[model samples]
Target: QAIYNIRNNPPQEDGACKLCNHQTIQRADETEEAITNRLEIYNQKTAPLIGYYEKEGLLKNFLSLIASDTIAEIKKSLKV
Candidate 1:
């Protein structure tokens, strides 16, 4: 979704990497098609790993981390 958003409506020249906090510059030559292809490849590679962890009941959903206390939630989940 993020990539698609960028592809369609790219950021102004002042975007930054969320993780590294570094300035980001979109390549002028990169196309939406290229980004979509890359995203598909990423999904294909990661889907099986995600499924494996889920099947083993080892996948810990951290999606609620922003709304709840992170440490407390992690501890509570670990107790089970």
Candidate 2:
């Protein structure tokens, strides 16, 4: 649904849509395949850092389901 909305509502940038005349951001690479590829690359790159940080005792994980819960956990972790 988010992907559909972003693709449909492309009015945050400078260029206008040729058909609808709505302003368009220049991110034509926000397609599903592109996003999937980016996620795969992110996981591949970050997987090793997780173990490295864990070994150094610098890893703090927050798996909260709610955004507010996660924010609270982050603040607690940072002693904010």
Candidate 3:
């Protein structure tokens, strides 16, 4: 769906999708080690918070889904 949106929408004046193009350059230049380091840092930061939430019975787990269905599933899970 995101790909479809990108294909159908007109590009900005710079010939890029402002929302999507921002990450392309940085991601393209990132090395595997950099990606792994980032993930390790992220996990270290979030693991304790996730554990706290779980202890408080505030953590909700959901299966991962395709991008197109994620919003719908989240809304449904939230009963919104």
Candidate 4:
């Protein structure tokens, strides 16, 4: 999955989302450098965080292949 965010947008005028009919904007940070920087930041921070959880036997890794599945897993883990 790509790492990026679309801010302040909902597509409309025949460009609505297929499922919700809501406008969706394309991510702006699609450049190779931008994406690489993001991944580097994530790798730098996430490893330590995950290490902490793993040491405590509380680590829960979720696959990001399908967004809905990952979100569902997160929600379930949070119990909310």
Candidate 5:
């Protein structure tokens, strides 16, 4: 789930280190303030935009703790 979120919603700027197997982790030279700013924007804006759908009763919250059972639960929740 964590990987999925990170990949689907990457940072505003695309950056990767040459030595780290092209990993998405921010480069060491980047300042801490840059990371904080990105997180703040995500928290203050991006997160809440998607949350609106959940608030409108059109979203399902799966139990991430039960990985194997998530699909079944989501299916049952959205039963037709």
Candidate 6:
């Protein structure tokens, strides 16, 4: 994957920070409570920095999807 390639030859700005795409492939009805719990744990342990990004207007939330769908979602988010 492109991500793996980038990991092996990382960009200069890539310090201790990580880059990733997080996805959950399930409808609301199919989502489990455990998923919420896991997100809570991640929020507690990993999301404070995201709050900082949000404050800076650099944070974005994308719906889960494949490559084509991801492009569509991005376009939608950008109002393009």
For model 5, the superposed segments whose C-alpha errors exceed 4 Å read 1-31, 78-80
- Computed on alpha carbons, the lDDT of every model, listed in order, comes to 0.69, 0.74, 0.65, 0.72, 0.63, 0.62
| TM-score sort, best first | 2, 1, 5, 3, 4, 6
Candidate 4 similarity to native, TM-score = 0.42
**Pairs clashing within candidate 2:** none
Cα RMSD, each candidate: 8.5, 6.4, 9.8, 10.2, 9.8, 17.4
Q: Which is the winner by lDDT between candidate 3 and candidate 5?
A: 3
TM-score of 2: 0.49
Q: Which ten residues in a row have the lowest lDDT in candidate 4?
A: 1-10
For model 4, the superposed segments whose C-alpha errors exceed 4 Å read 1-28, 61-80
Better candidate number, 3 or 4, judged by lDDT: 4
Identify the runs in model 2 with alpha carbons over 4 angstroms from their true place. Answer: 1-28, 31-37
lDDT of 4: 0.72
Best by TM-score: 2
Ranked candidates (lDDT, high to low)? 2, 4, 1, 3, 5, 6
Candidate 1 at residue 47, lDDT?
A: 72
Displacement of residue 71 (Cα, Å) in model 6 is 0.6
For model 6, what is the alpha-carbon lDDT of residue 78? 88
**Which pairs of residues collide in candidate 6?**
none
Report the number of the highest-lDDT candidate. Answer: 2
* Residue lDDT tens for model 1, 1-80: 13424656544445755545566665654767887888898899977898899999999876553655776788888994
Number of residue pairs clashing in candidate 2, backbone atoms closer than 3 angstroms, sequence gap of 3 or more or interchain: 0
lDDT of 3 by residue, 30-74 (tens): 556887888898899977899899999988776665865777787
Instruction: Give the TM-score (vs. native) of candidate 5.
Output: 0.47
C-alpha-based local distance difference test score of model 2: 0.74
Query: Pairs clashing in candidate 5?
Result: none
